[model samples]
Target chain A: METEKLFEITAYTENQVGLLSAIAGIFTRRSLNIEKLLVYPSQIAGIHKFKIITRAAEAQIQTVVLQIEKKVDVIKSYYEVDNERSCREIDDVRQFLQERETESNNI
Target chain B: MEQKITGAEAFWRSLLEEQVKVVFGYPGGQIMPVYDHYWNYQAQIRHVLVRHEQGAIHAAQGYARASGIPGMVLVTSGPGATNVVTGVADAMIDSTPVVVVAGQVPCQLLGKDAFQEIDLIGMATPITKWSYQIRRAEDVAWAVSRAFYIARTGRPGPVVLDFTKDAQAGLVDYAPKPCHFIRSYVPDPQVSESQLDEAARMIDEARKPFVVYGQGILLSGAEKELAAFLEKGAIPAGSTLLGLGALDSGNPHLKGMLGMHGNLAPNVMTQHCDLLVAVGMRFDDRVTGKLDTYARQARIIHIDIDPSEIGKLVPVDLGIVGDARKVLAGLTERIAPRTTREWQMEPILCDAVEKHKVIEPEIQPGTGEINPGEVVACVAEAVKGEALIVTDVGQNQMLAARYSRFVRPHSFISSGGLGTMGFGLPAAIGAKIAAPERTVVVFLGDGGLQMTFQEMGTIMQEGTDVKIVLLNNNWLGNVRMWQQLFFQERYSCTRMLNPEFTGIAQAYGIPSLHVETREELPSAIRQMFAQEGPFLLDVHVREESMVFPMIPPGSSVDEIMLNNEDWFNYGD
Candidate 1:
């Protein structure tokens, strides 16, 4: 039997309006939950990059990446394992912000 | 090198460049500039004035579906754009390509809650494949080019463009550039040979294999290819509602339709087949009742243009992403002709049960209370499979999908996914305009006719001859059937308080007739077709009749109720 896995998909495209929501709509229609998402301007001028983390079967995510690439606004989109992931630690960042809050209260 | 022009002129010129012969539109406040220009270019592009903007979109869908070309729509801001949301969503779900351009307030008044202003781009994004807000008249050509390209490419769907009023009024040099490609927007992906091999092997080895398809077949124009593939392999086929005409319905290898309210053999075969080959059709809930139980024993293979639909519903052993016709050609190329006698009883029993139990009793020719099925039968007989049958949602739509004899592709047009109620009236007009040589028939339920009956005026003015078959059951028959079976017969608002429909048709200057008995039903249908112009036939039918072999909600395929006895004998 097939089991679910975490997938990270990275997309590059010329920055245009409604590109993010259009990509998100692909995931939303399939009922796949995005674990994390990050989008920013690429190193190349006028080019933007997107990184999405979703938990689903590999085939499902592959289909998602394929759909994302079908958008004319999207330059290229593919899935990978590590570089595709958003490396920010969830609890560590939260704890660091909490410590900052405590120190500010003491001051 | 280029002449300057107004936004409205650029819009019309760009459409002319795109070879858009007709556009369904309604003029409004924010859309005045475009209409003002429309007055000048009525010769080049025919602007069909629909009573409501919603009708314009549906009409555009019919035109697109019939012509296999992108349909076009023009509506004003706010309510005009929003009114078409349903039809846009319908196009999106059904993969009908349509380009909708709505007027906006202006750039200066952006987000100020101006009159006749709404963020149409935002509202249309989820429903359309793509959308753009044209703030500058200079960008009009670029946006129109991209909108048409995107709307008609890959999996075809609706694309909306909202232009600011100032843009429509502004003057600029318009140079229409044909959209070639977006860096990543690949309309046709190469079919994976390995997946094709895998599917071919499975089809060859499986004792009992089933072929199921949907609208994508018609969209791809793969009817001939699908027929060759099925014939070469001697495979039995079933169709979703949209896939009806993709294969000759009378083909002996055709098992029948498969879904809720589908015929007997195909629905049951879904559970029993060893291998399930889905071509161009999604495994929608209606097609696969209780997915947990659907095709459990079968190894599944999906061939479709859209990758996202591959494993969205059912687990796939092999998923191929390509156009249906191309992929089917590739797969058939890999396998030699093979035949299997596995489960021969399945299709034979299905045919026997359908003919003996369903078709025989329903259409045995009687003159008592005029049955809806008989009306469909008579209309089908009158048209002789030559006309395009467009229908509004509810029982009438299902009956048209199920009973109508559609021998040609694009002959059956209806709101399949969104199931819009008043879709037939204006859509029939568009279909007539698209193919003026062919007859166009509009079937509307009592509940549906009341929704957009005003479009009769548009029909009279345009002089597009369409025969309107109104099956007046005096109730919302589909939902009422549901209430009868599942809701303990507690009829709520199912009953429709209808006006004198013939009077309403006469008011629109269309020849109208009323039929109450089976004796005159066929002649009335023939007379409607014989009329030189638009005609309306208000057919009074059995009040409680519903499409049979329905898979009750939350039930499995084998649990389909064949008829009233199946429902009554086996109570909820």
Candidate 2:
């Protein structure tokens, strides 16, 4: 059995109605209880941030993060061991979108 | 200056901006405002009034699959909204593009359980790509545009817009908000060049490689790309049930359908292949039985547009997240061409074994009551694999997928992920409506037909020219087969005392034919096609009929059951 650990998942998203419940529903479906939850504005204008702490297997967290990022309003999502300060994925997503814009412009 | 218009008019304007030509819908109290505006927009858009809300959504799904455009649905709140929940889930799992706008009570009345109001957003959130409630008329255009944008892009699925009565009645400065981009959403993911190189290297190194694909190919319009990729590599390919029409059945590299009750060649080769390349298909349990033992020896590469689907089920050595067309084109450019036909010829042996043991007996018994496979085979012959075939769940779906040959893309539509029983009748109607030039044929079991048989009225009213072929075995044949094989043949409630279906068809003004014997089968199918409008050919097949070359539940793909007494020996 894979050992369960407490992970912190952060998601940057568009401020859309019912997004809170929509994101909460994912954790509900997996029966993973959110230990702590925080929602506030991010440094990037118009983007909101959600910091959630939950206990789950590494595999579950990997899929959960991916599923969170799958939401239409979610810009970028990542997970890390509690208090590890891992690299942010939002910058990478921004870079990816910027490159796509450049490519489309060239076309 | 933009004219101030009611939200109702704004809704119609939004659809017009999207270039939507048709919608499948039924209206009631809360949504009456939107329906009222329909009178003015009637010149621009056509509305299909289905018998039920469930029929509306399934029809919409069929339209999307058939036309390669996002299908639209509009229904009232409460029961109307609740009715579409099944199809919303079906569309989600199938990756179909549909936008559903359901009416809601006035903004103030929400949460008070007002008359004809339900928590549609709450109920639809989990099932839909995006579910939002439009409480203000000003938000109508924005919400509708975003709904279409999200529903049609990036692994497309259903979207729900809960329209409140107050919002519909309020005034808005309606200018079309055509949402071309959303900062939060990326419809197309960029492919990694290094990943493509690794995939090419693996394909070049492997002597025996197998390709399993699903509806993603058709959804991505990657049929030509897939064919070119397979041809360049000399790789044999098999399609999932929904992936049937993606590759032309006549394509030389195309082996057959894969999964339980799929062909012998693909299922056996799944085990023997050294490298497995899966594209646009999630590793559904139905396709990969006993996952631990499935393709254990193969170095697997899974390519899909949905990032979450990459490693959700079957872990892969390389997972490419991009459109199938883009990825396949990239791989085709990178990979070396192979001219050898030795490994590709492997299916010949399995096909021979399947034909002698399974195919001949099931499709051409020569001396029995009409077998279901025979009916499918007869239709395949009559249509010459030129019809858009839709099927209800159970034995009908499997047999149609197995026997029906396809020469075109998007010619096969069935409820693959959700397995909705009453999907066929309405879906065929939608397909026929979307593509009136094409011949649309639907295969339905006796059990599934009655679930939404009232849609025959819709067919009658719309004058839909669908060929309805009822495989009337008078039993829940799929469940019965399971009972016969695994449950000591208890027979339970699987048996049904079915009503005279021809009489029902006659009542709906559809020309009908009942064929109980083998001699009448061919002419009945010919008559079905030869007629102008709708025709129902109810075939009374053998009650004890079974689909053979089966992989009993919880078994490996190669461990196939040829018949009641014999298991397929791979060596033979």
Candidate 3:
């Protein structure tokens, strides 16, 4: 049996309703729990990005990412082992978003 | 100036633009607007009113499988939408192309839990090729076209469109939105020349090559290509259940069906071959019993249109992601032609053993209660392998697959991947309606027949010339067989006190006959085909009858049970 580890999955998709649940359902069907999930508009116009953190075997994560990309709205999806550097990068992105929100409020 | 029309009118117009002439549907409160407009388009589109919502979707699946077009379905919200979910899942797994439009509660009532409101898109997402909610009239044309396009292209599957009541009643300037492409979707991947060359080299080098295929060949319209590929390599091929009609049953290169209840030769040859070429069929557990032992001696090559399916199950040495037609044609051109090989005689030996041990006793039993396989053979003889054959799940399905002969593509339709029990009757209705010129015969067990027998009402109303053959055994024969073998005869809930089916057929205004003795079998089948709009022939098969040459679940393909006391030992 393969060892389970925390993996971060990134998916780019069209801005369509119910797609978040559609992608998440793949994980749920496999009985994998999501530790964190973030859905937001991406830098590319009309595209949405989803960052999900889950613990699963690498083989299961490969299929889950493939199934997520199989959805009609999903443009692409990738998964990789989550590490301290990647975790810091996620926090930095969150902090950058908060700073942008504060600046917009000041305006 | 754009033509302003209601969303319901747009729905009909969009169907017209897609050249869809028939739709199977049921109506309720939320979908009343669409039904109201359906009246105006009656002259252009023929809508078959099914007995239930499940019947509607299964019929659409049948129509799609028969006509090689996306079957269209319309249903109301809540129960109506939920009812079709089983058939939708069936079509998804079987790769049948069907488009379903279900009415939802108005947009405002979506999340508020209003009357007849449910999250249909959420429910359908996992099972459909694509699922979208049309909340506005403007999105109807686009969504409908997109749904049909997605449902019918590449590896075909079911698609769902949730039409809110407001969308049905809303007005929009309607224009045909023809969808041929989606930016995120690549329906057909290009064939890789390097992979084809590698596959050809492997096929050429292998001493014993075997091919196991599935419904992908028919879905790709590559029956001729498959035949050519097999002929060029002089390879024997076995078909998955859904792949039955893709190759003519009499084709010399065609071995037989492959699965738990499939033929002896293919299962045995699977263990003996050195190279395995799989086309279009997934490595379903039923086909590959105990995957660890499945073709372990063979270097497998999997060719499929879907990228996810290539390495999903049995890892392949060469995985070609492309249309079956293109890949087969490419490989055929590259591979060398062979005349004969030592492996060619393997099936002949297996066939001899099977004919004496299994086939003769089941299909040509001289004395005793009528056997289910006998009925299938009689029907095959009556139709001369010309009729469209449909089957429900379990023993009847296996018997039909074993005995029925097909000379053309798309002549056999069954619930393959999902094994939906009630699929046969409604699917027969759809097949007959889709191809009125051909005879449509459905073989279902007593258990499966009752699951969707209400579709007889639909058949009676539409005058669909479908022949219904019920293999009545008074038990869920397949499960009963398993119980006897694996579960120590603990029948559990396998027994059924079946109703007098002929009486039910009579009530539905359908001609009926019941065959109990072996003598009545041939004539009863003849009477069914003699002169009929629709006829039901129920044969009471042996209560303890079992489908033999069986690969008991979890056993390797070669570990076959030939009879109650005998197991097949190769070269015995």
Best by lDDT: 2
Query: In candidate 3, what are the lDDT values of residues B1-572, reduced to their tens digit?
Result: 97689999999999999999899999999999999999999999999999999999999999999999999999999999999999999999999999999999998877999988999988998899899999999999999999999999988999999999999999999999998877677678779999999999999999999999999999999999999988888999999999999999999999999989899999999999999999999999999999889999999999999888877778789999999999999999999999877797889999999999999999888887878888899899889889999999999999999999999999999998899999999999999889999999999999999999889889989989999999999999899988999999999999999889999999988999988898878888888899669999988999998998899889899999989999999988
Candidate 1 lDDT, B434-497, residue by residue in tens: 9899899888899888888888989989998998998889999999999998899999989988
User: What TM-score does chain A of model 2 get?
Assistant: 0.86
**What share of the reference contacts survives in each candidate?**
0.56, 0.66, 0.54
* Candidate 2 regions with alpha-carbon error over 4 angstroms: A87-107
Order candidates by lDDT, high to low: 2, 3, 1
lDDT of each residue in A10-99, candidate 3, tens digit only = 887889878988988898888999999999987666778898999998878887887887887787777879453344434444554455
Over the stretch A1-107, how does candidate 2's per-residue lDDT look in tens digits? 78999999999888888889999999999999999999998776777999999999988898899999999889889999959674556677677557756765664
Candidate 1, position B194, lDDT: 81
Residue pairs in clash, model 2: none
Superior candidate under lDDT, 1 versus 2: 2
- DockQ each candidate and list the results: 0.24, 0.59, 0.27
Residue B259 CA displacement from its true place in model 1, Å: 0.6
True contacts kept of 2: 0.66
RMSD of each: 8.1, 1.6, 5.5
Best candidate per TM-score, number?
A: 2
lDDT accuracy of residue B236 in candidate 2: 94
Query: Which has the higher DockQ value, candidate number 1 or candidate number 3?
Result: 3
